[model samples]
Target chain A: MSKALLYDATLCIDCKQCEAACADQNKLPYDDNIAKEERQSEHKFTAVLSKNDKYMRRLCMNCQEPACVSVCPVAALRKTSEGPVIYEANRCMGCRYCMAACPFGVPKYEWSSLNPKVRKCTMCPDRVLAGRQTACAENCPTGATKFGDRDELINEARKRIQDNPANYIHHIYGVEEVGGTSVLLLSGVPFEEFGYRTDFPRDPLPLRTYQVLSKIPDFIPLGFVTLGGIWWITHRREAVAAAEGRQAHQAGKELK
Target chain B: MKIKFTFWKAVFLLIVAAGAYGTFVRFFRGLGASTNLSDQFPWGIWIGFDVLCGVMLAAGGFTLTAAVHILNIQRLKPIVRPTILTAFLGYVLVSVALLFDLGRPYNIWHPLIMRNPHSVMFEVAYCVMLYTTVLALEFSPIVLERFNLQKPLKVVKAVLIPLVLLGVILSTLHQSSLGTLYLIMPTKLHPFWYTPLLPVFFFLSAIAVGLAMTIFESSMSSKHFGRELELPILQELGRVLLVVLTVYAILRFEDLLHRGVFHQLLVAGYERNLFLLEIVLALVLPLTLLAIPKIRQSAGGLYLAAVSVVLGFITNRLNVSITGMETAAGLHYVPKWTEIAITGAIIAVGFALFALAVNYLPIFPEHREAAGPEAPVAAKAAVLSHAGD
Candidate 1:
């Protein structure tokens, strides 16, 4: 029920404008190694992925039944009504089982800090609930990271691929990758080249966790002894009782 | 029951403190602070050593119990209670170890309250809880009978079979599940450790480990208690272990061949060396030692073989969970000091409990004929029958 944003890296411009806006808005320090070292980097709803010939924007795809939410063990991570994966750090025990379980590796742990929060792109659920467009979409200079309903986004992605065959790959990056992420991408090169897993599974990771867990009967044969030991004890008690009864019989015969 | 503080008691208190400290740190901070667990190797020593392999090593309690009780071999009675206590302690350690790995220890109740039928973790949680309770109930009569609570003991005795059967069923589900937990990570697991038949592999290894543990624990306990051991039955148990280990070896390679990952085993690396070590220690060494009566009859030889087999099984599990796991992206892992301390403390508690149980409760058999090497089946059965009650 949440909406996801898709970014086509070919359209990003690495002007550092989005990063500046995000740092200012999120109260994060400017681009400096000290802030990074502090392990307190505030995650932007959208990030302009740096160090490549073409700029890539990074953000959460707002997966349906998100793996982080599924493997929360507790409902620390939740999917809001409007379709955004949100976090409640206070209730979180900081157990990063969610980080491991996510196939996309979307959740980042604040490892250096005594109190760490899992950092990821939240879909701006607070704004969406208030009937506002996301800050990332409004601020995007090239319209690379789009915000819209998933249905409309996919249609838009398809139309772009059809309109400019030379500029776009026929496939949308997140549309079918891992069971159709809310985000959709239209790009010139293959998804694999862009550092996105194009062949990821649509099936939620929890099911796979379950499939292996179900076959645990491997220890049952060993448990047979629990019952057998009980049986042995019972027999031993009976033998003791018999021995006592024989002693009483001998005493009675001696009295006769 | 109050007396001078014993050596085992001191050790137990240390374990409790270490375990408590680990939990406190986990609650205050997070898993990264307390463990070497990472995105690459989410399941570190806790899952590999504690849950996967520890349970199998603990399998001796049930194997010895079944041999003595169900088979009417009375000779096995002396070791039964001690073995059960060990098993109970083993399960407790495994359950506690799980808390270290869980992200939200407080929310552990959510799984019980909110049933996720599809979650492998759900089954593991349910079985661990159920089996732990079953283990406690099964062990209660020992405490009760000692206290002269005839009525409670009677009630327990009446329901023993069904409770044990329930335990067996639950054990089957969780043990195989430990192996099955890795099945989905086909890409993550090294070829030597992976296959659709992972469940069967886990099952076989557990049986062998259980038998080997009985051999080792029994022999080791005898050193402390000075009770005469029924060495012949243990030799027979060793033979059973040989069969299971042999089958397991064949299947290990068979699974690799089936999956076309046979070459993966020979790829010169740590994983390959670890896998080879597991085979040589757990299977080939024990198998060769136990095959010839000359070597098998010696308590020293057989006991060494059993210890090696147990070590081998631990290596096998490590390979399955740690050595073989392909991370999302990263290098190899090493557990944090807190994690290692916690694991060590857990085994110490197991030994402490075993020591206490053997000392106080009737753990060892009273007296038995010394085997002059060979023992016919009838003589063996007779020796077993006269061992305890």
Candidate 2:
């Protein structure tokens, strides 16, 4: 079963226990400053922002068709079947194309390191593979962040919304945006109020690039034939002109 | 050859020295210390100017080779060597700048072995690597002749046509692929610059800038090296420039109108103003100057128009890479002094190397004919020796 995390903004208490659990699980250093930070960074893979008297958790969306995965020149970023977008640090050339490509802007670079690596939420790939819950979900005090099968979670989210329509917005954020993400969100207010991009296309972002890239194979042969034909005709014309000039010179010499 | 310790040379050396220090700092302390780049703006001038503008500016190589070798416009032959040399050096410097910009410069070759054809970046990487090699091969004849290596020269000459064809193909792929790099970022990029026709826009502008660079280089060489200007050829090029600029302008506005982003131009803001400035510098200025036969005929006027095109090309690329994304990024980005220093050093090295190459090699045609009645038999012989193969 493909795993997923459902984050309910109304239920989050902003106690930051999930943040602490994420830092601990990832073995990243955390402190007062990191706790106060509302933005995800190389050190902070996840953050909980306070907006409109509600706490919203920010992390990698782990898209079904990840833009970062597609744009990585060296296959450094990959979308695992376990519903996580993982990074192979060894494979990364540090081109940062992934950083630029991520619509959510989730990937953060360790720019201060001489040998830098892109840092982002892995959704606890190891634990998920071991049939265990992610640290954030495991440590959530209020069941605000729940991890389970993606399909079941979507059903649960729909049930909650259908059961109480007035308490929740009509839209489910990650269901269709950028062709669906592993992480789903339920918010009482509009997602745009919390600085989420509400304008993302319904289709996967990589499709846009592939639309142009797919034509390159056809373009290559056509380019060669056109260029080669031009070369042949022009060179042949030059050769014929040179040959006639020689013949003309020979005839003139005979007359003399 | 003796070196001159002129004031300009001193300045060049200082900038290079500063750049070397910046490089050292960049490698040791990492990109965070050397640049103002952040998570929001992962790319800066190094990618925009050094890599993007650098590659586009070097388009002169494929353009001239196509004209002279494929199209049989032998009149442009005199400037081909210098143009190739500029391109070779431009690509080499772009690679050098990539070292400064890439977080792991040592692993730059990963793209070669770890192939991802789906990525536009992957295609760009392959094209740049392959085209740089092609440029090197295209440029080797000059070096071979200087050393009097007959055997290898014959072999290279025999394959020159195929090599030129390959360069054009590769140039076309990557020059437009640079624009394709932004296609995936439709949400991030502003609509004014974002269109499905980005690749076409990029390809067209590269050609225009390529011609402009040729004219610019010719004028610079004539003024500095005390060589006679190739006025008739440049005048002819100016007319071509006019046509290309007109087409590019028409297509660009048409794209904007078609995308229904033409109204964005009416909105008073930084992006709109910058767009206007880019159009004026890149399109309007050059088009107006080149359309006038009197200005096109004059060397000074032609130089001014070419410079405008070059500057405007720089602006356009920068706008696409930086300004277009700034509003979406929700923050302003400015390159650090170290970033500026390194960029300056790279350009300075290009100038220094070009001067050295010109001083040492047979970059210009030996015979002097300023569009004189007499046929340039010697110059034609030099070019035909390669073309005949």
Q: First chain TM-score in every candidate? A: 0.75, 0.94
DockQ each candidate and list the results.
0.22, 0.84
Give the runs in model 2 whose Cα sits over 4 Å from its true position.
A245-256, B1-4, B367-389
TM per prediction: 0.79, 0.95
Best by lDDT: 2
Off by over 4 Å in 1: A15-47, A69-72, A75-83, A86-95, A110-119, A126-135, A188-195, A198-204, A207-256, B1-32, B38-42, B62-76, B184-187, B293-298, B326-328, B367-389
> Looking at model 2 chain B, which ten-residue stretch has the lowest summed lDDT?
B380-389
Model 1, residue A190: distance off in Å is 5.3
For residues B284-332, what per-residue lDDT tens digits would candidate 1 score against the true structure?
8988997888888888888988889888888888888777764334477
Candidate 1, residues A114-201, lDDT tens digits: the string is 6567777676667777776566666778877777777777778777778888887778877665566765666666666545676566
lDDT per residue as tens, model 2, A115-143: 99999999999999899999999999999
Model 2, span B216-264: residue lDDT tens: 9898777666679999989878888898899999999888888899777
